[model samples]
Target chain A: MKVVVQEALFDPWEEVRNYQQQNLPRGKHGGSVIFVGTMRDFNEGVDGISRMYLDHYPGMTEKHIERVCEDAMNEWDIMDAYVVHRVGEINPDEPIVLVAVWSRHRAMAFDACRFIINDLKHRAPFWKREQRPEGEHWVEGNTADERAARIAS
Target chain B: MKVSVKYFANMRDRMGRADETVELDEGATVASLWAKVSDEPMPENTLIAVNMEYTNTEEALKDGDEVAFFPPVTGG
Candidate 1:
């Protein structure tokens, strides 16, 4: 299993290439799955989002993200996994985070990818501050995120 | 003792700076700093991370600590 975390402005493609490998599914080892999260321009009838502030609990963020990956490894025969999350400052249309997983079979890869991303959404010690054209506010946590996390628990 | 108080994102904007060195009375706790800084109206959306870990405003703080005060996170 592999996990990476960094702070970047906005570069989804570059970050994705970092973890993608040619030998992903060699002997059916090619069950590769990827998840990309993009920032939206508008929210809740609000005009639009200019930029967003991504914050993380420095110490806990890394550890918690790793734990999510470890959990996936335990249930499946996953070979490798990579999780990259950027922090600092990010704007709309930016790629905030990416989770890539590889396994000998497709099922494990897809399930692991979904599990990792879902867990991170709910449990990671990160918060967002949205800056819309009209004004700004802290993006409230969604019930969906909480419910998604509960399933894994 | 003097500790490094870091401000990130909007917190940095509202605090008008990213970091500062503050002198705390001996035995100062996290609550004490909140009581002191909360009055500044830096920003309502700000959260505190003490010693590189996210912490509630009421948590205790000690000397030689590195605290980062910033807005909520938006990461995958």
Candidate 2:
């Protein structure tokens, strides 16, 4: 398991490839599930967001994500998990996060990947301040996980 | 006793400082710590962490502990 919280921009594909090469043995894992979250140009009905500043509680943010990955490991029969998240200034279309899970089969990989990302969205100690054409504003809250909400009801 | 209190995101702006050392009575809970720091009522969505771990306002705070207050997390 690996978790990285960085300010530098990263290539999600490269991260996935490197982690698999270094960690997962050849033919050891049959499938990998990867999820990448990117910044959108519009939010909260505001369009043409030029940039975004992500503020994170440094030590706490890492710890929280690590716990999420650890929980995924415990809950699923996955071989390993890798998570990379970007902090600091970001532009539209830039990848903000990457969550990859490897398992002997695709089912566990898919479920664990979704679980990790969903948990991170809700629990991580990170805040976003977007620079829109109108002005800057702190994002008030995250949108509900529609599928999860429906399932829980 | 004193605890170091940190604010993040909007809370930092609202508090007008990133961090501050706050005085508190022995066995003071997080709620009382907030009472000493700010005049505004704590928002219902306020999130708190004690010593870097998520906790409630009623969690007992110790001397030299680190407390953080922030709005609801909005990250992905």
Candidate 3:
């Protein structure tokens, strides 16, 4: 599995291609599955969301993200996985994060990919600071997050 | 017991630096260190992480722990 924390912009399509290419050597057995998370324009019906600030609790965040990735690896017969999340500032239509999974079958890839995103949302030490027209708001974690994390506990 | 305080994104800009590793007393709690070191309101709203878990300043600490403070992450 490969996990990267960077401050550069990524083309979603390019990222998917890279993941597919990297694991293509195992194409005889594992089928590649890709998941891309993109930025949305609207926020609670509010207009003028020019950009979003990417901030994270560093030490805790990297560890938790890696843990979730490792769990995905162990639970499935996956060949490889990649998680790349961009931090700093991002504009609308930018790629926020990407998680790609590969396995011999689609089921394993799909389930494991979903689990990774869910776990990261719930357990990872990261928060969303959305910048909007009115002001900046600290996004709150949801019940689903708390629920997903209990699996680890 | 010293924990390095690092900030990312806008918090970095506000703090005028990216990373700050500070030394504290042998038995300083997160809350107490916050009051002693944090001079400005933490860029309006911020999140604190102790060790490798998202935590609050009320959480206690042990030696050799790394404390990080920053704004919430908006990345998907």
Candidate 4:
């Protein structure tokens, strides 16, 4: 498993290729699932977001992501998983994060990929501040209680 | 006891600094640390973590603990 927290933009295809080359043996995995999250021009039904500034705890962000990946690995029968999240300033339409999982069966790959992304959304310690034409605002979403409820049900 | 208090996102902006070493009483919990550091009222739904793990305000603190406080996360 590989977990990365960086500010540089990444090529999703190149990342997948590198992960497979370095971690997976040929014919060892039958299926791979990948998810890329990109910065959008709008959020929370508000449009015209010009850019986004992502902030994270330096020493803790990577560790939290690794823990989330480990949890997914333990819950599924996946061979390998990789997560890359970008921080700092990001323009609209740029990639923000990536999650990929390799498994011998498509079922495990799909399930594990979903689980990792969902868990990352709830568990990761990253914050976003949006710059707009009018002004800047911090985006607020589900609270911890709401997140716990969603996970429980 | 000296505890490292780190802020992120808007909290960092509001505090005008990223992090600082705060002096608190021994056996201080996360809540007391937050009250000591933040001048403004703690925002609703602010998240706290200790030593890289998610923690509640009531959790007891030890000397040299790294404490972080920030707003709710908004990442995908």
Top of the candidates by lDDT: 2
TM-scores, all candidates, are 0.68, 0.98, 0.72, 0.92
Locate the minimum summed-lDDT window of 10 residues in model 4 chain A.
Answer: A140-149
Cα lDDT of model 2 by residue, B37-62, tens digit: 98989988999999999999889998
Residue A72 of model 1 has an lDDT of: 94
Q: Model 1 misses residue B68 by how many Å?
A: 2.3
Q: For candidate 1, please provide the TM-score of chain A on its own.
A: 0.84
The best-first sequence of candidates by TM-score reads 2, 4, 3, 1
In candidate 1 the C-alpha lDDT for residue A71 amounts to 88
Interface RMSD score of each model:
3.5, 0.6, 4.0, 1.4
Sort all candidates by lDDT, best to worst: 2, 4, 1, 3
Candidate order (DockQ)? 2, 4, 3, 1
TM-score, predicted candidate 2 vs. hidden true structure: 0.98
The whole-model C-alpha lDDT of candidate 4 against the native structure comes to 0.87
Query: Cα deviation in Å at residue B37, candidate 1?
Result: 2.7
lDDT of 3 at A79: 72
1 against 4, candidate with superior lDDT: 4
| Evaluation by TM-score, superior candidate among 1 and 4 | 4
Model 2 Cα lDDT, one tens digit per residue, A30-148: 88999999999999788999999999999999999999899999999999999999999999999999999999999999999999999898999999999989888999988788998
Candidate 3: the clashing residue pairs are A127-B72, A127-B73, A128-B73
Candidate 1 residue A97 C-alpha distance from true site, Å = 2.2
Model 4 chain B: weakest 10-residue lDDT segment is B37-46
